[model samples]
Target: MINRYGPYKRYKQVFGVTSHSNPDKEHTVVITDKGEWQCSCPAWIFHTPRKPCKHIQEAMKDQVVQAFTPKPITPKVEKVLNRFAAIEV
Candidate 1:
C-alpha cells in the first residue's frame, strides 16, 4: 500500500459493472484510499450530495469477503501468554 507518495494506499478490489440499460456499457466502482465511494457513471458525476449508484450498490453487496479485524487482547490475557511463552516445553 505504500508508495513514493508516502503511505499511499488504495482498495485492492475494483468492480467493473455492466450498465443496466446498455449492456454494452460498463462502469468502474471503487472505494478510494480516502474511504470515499465512487463510481464511473453519469449519476456519479451530477449528484449534488453524492449517492451510491446502482453499480456501486451491486458491488457493495457482492463484497461478501471483507478485511479482517484483530481483537485486542486484555492485559490479563497478555500476562498469561507471556508466562506461557517463558515456560520451557
Candidate 2:
C-alpha cells in the first residue's frame, strides 16, 4: 500500500514527497536533479533491488505518463530537384 503527499519542489530540478502505508511512519520520496526517483523506505532499501517504489511512482505519475505517451510525428515532404541542372563554376 502507498500514500501520496504530492510532489513538492526541493530545489532546482529536484522534487520530493512524503508517503507511507502505515500512519505511524512516513518516508520521503525524492526525484533527483537528473530525473531519477528514490524512496527512503524499507521496501526500497532491502527489497525491489532499485525498482521504483509506490511512493516514487505516485510522485512521478505525471512524468511517467508523459514519458510513455508518444508524440505526433510530422511527415516530411521531399522537394524535387532537376537532375540535369548545370553545376555552378
Which sections of candidate 1 miss by over 4 Å?
1-9, 65-89
Off by over 4 Å in 2: 1-20, 62-89
lDDT tens per residue, model 1, 20-71: 8877665655555666666667786567677898887887776664553323
Per-residue lDDT tens digits for candidate 2, residues 1-89, read: 22323223431122233444456554555554456665556676656447887766766674443333222221210010111012111
Q: Which residue pairs of candidate 2 clash?
A: none
Let me know the TM-score candidate 2 reaches against the reference structure.
0.44
lDDT score of residue 88 within candidate 2:
11
Every candidate's lDDT:
0.52, 0.42
Model 1 clash pairs?
none
What total of clashing residue pairs does each candidate reach? 0, 0
